[model samples]
Target: MNLRDIDLNLLLVFDRMLAERRVSAVAQSLGLSQPAVSNALARLRRALGDELFLRTAQGMVPTPLAMQLAEPVAAAMSALHGALNQSTAFDPATSTRSFTLAMTDIGEVYFTPRLMERLNQVAPGIRISTVRNTAVNLRDEMEAGQVDIAIGLLPQLKAGFYQRRLFMQRYVCLFGKQHPLAAKSRLTLKDFASADHVLIQAAGTGHGQVDEQMAAQGIARKVRLVVPHFVAVGHILQSQPMIATVPEKLARALAEPFGLAVRAHPADLPQVAINAFWHARFHREPGNRWLRELLTETFAEG
Candidate 1:
């Protein structure tokens, strides 16, 4: 079938339908009515001479032809989107676009306040919203233009995207000011192993690298608590005689506020590089470029 013969707009519907297998979801994401999405699917089916997707109880299951066409169609759509947005001018002060960013808990703590401050002063109308990186598939969401950019140690956003390193941070042990280890400027391996630990399994991020690095050296800490986020670690350490391993910069931020003391990690952990990732489709998008440049300028460590 010749591409020119079919309505190119139908391809947009087809692509979204593939990403979100349900008609209702496609409709919601595309800002169209459920019937409208179904109608477009019907027209595409007639034009293509194939039942591209089979309606099933679970979701709209793609047929063999749909599966075959998915990649090329997605690529073409992305390229076309890039081309359309390439020349558009983005005036931050005047634009009222709301951009959704994917971030981990630590990322929100480190990035949000600063970003908001700068944005409020410069781009007062533009809005910023955030979603947990673990909550959505970063690659898929970014490719679909649902997520503007992701920040943190997202190792999954590798292929088909661009990444810029904001900074490298080593792990530090945060201890209560009154804790026995806090007396020492730096912690020793013996102090680390003897103390009960609050392990922040910052899932969906590269925080696990800390654990792996520790294990490689045969250093084992007594895991007293395992939390999923970094928010409460400072509070936990403040009240308990526990050492929490965390990013050095974050540790310093929490030290005085939480009555916690930051010390060099007893174990030599690999430095984790925090990065910003955006899909190639939106690499040249004027607004996207502005946001990423804002992130770099505000946070990049020399």
Candidate 2:
């Protein structure tokens, strides 16, 4: 098919259909009649050489090709919207916009309160959505405009995305106040290895790395549980005999209130650096620049 012959507006309807998964909902979102949306979908299906969507009892389910095109199409629309909405003067006081952020549990716990406080002070009507940080393809998310910002220790990031170091944090061992380890001022590698542990593997880098680190020192910790987030680890340690190693900043935040004791890691473990990530496309955008500045300021204070 000739690119010049295709109408770009059909992509907008396709994106809405993907998001709402119902013709009526897509029509409502686009402020069009149901028949108008259906007509647009018909044009899109011919342009894309596929049915695009199948009517199921649940909703309008996307074909495999439609599913594959969803992210890029949505991202393009978002970028277009942002470009059209750009202004020389950004008055946060009157602007009502929602921003989506991808961050780890620790980041959400530490940075969100400060961010929300600042937003409320300046933009009372603004909204925010936070997505879980997973070991997924983030470069595509940023490039497509699905995620405005990503905050975490994304060591294996792809090229083209801009990164700024936000803060440096080390890991510390945490246990319940009433646990036996809490009685000790410090813990040795042997103490850490012998205890039942709760492992927080956010990046899906299984316990192999931790085990390898311990094995280098001829130590082995019995990993009784493997959780996806540090918050869950804290919950497990609250009443259990499980000891967990978590980022020092997060541990410090939860230590007192959770009645947990923190101790230094016996072995020389790697210190994690948290960073803010964004697409180069927004490197000069005024609103994006302002948001990045706010993020840096908030994290720097901690």
How many backbone clashes does every candidate have?
Answer: 0, 0
Instruction: In model 2, state the lDDT of residue 270.
Output: 70
TM-score of 2: 0.69
lDDT of 2 by residue, 149-257 (tens): 8888776553446788888777789999989988999998778878998877766422235546667877677989987667676677899998887778888888887
Alpha-carbon TM-score of each model against the true structure = 0.84, 0.69
In Å, residue 205's CA in model 2 sits off its true spot by: 6.8
Pairs in steric clash, model 2: none
| Candidate 1: tens digits of C-alpha lDDT, residues 1-302 | 77789999899999998878889998999899999999999999999899999988967888999988876787787788878767778899998999999987787777888899999999999989999888655666887788999988888776567899999999888889999877788777998899998999877777898899889999998999999899998788889998888898788778888899888877767788889998776777889999999999999988
Q: Give, for candidate 1, the lowest lDDT window spanning 10 residues.
A: 135-144
**Top candidate, metric TM-score:** 1
Q: Which stretches of candidate 1 lie over 4 Å from their true place?
A: 1-7, 27-58, 61-72
**Residue 46 deviation, candidate 1, in Å?**
9.0
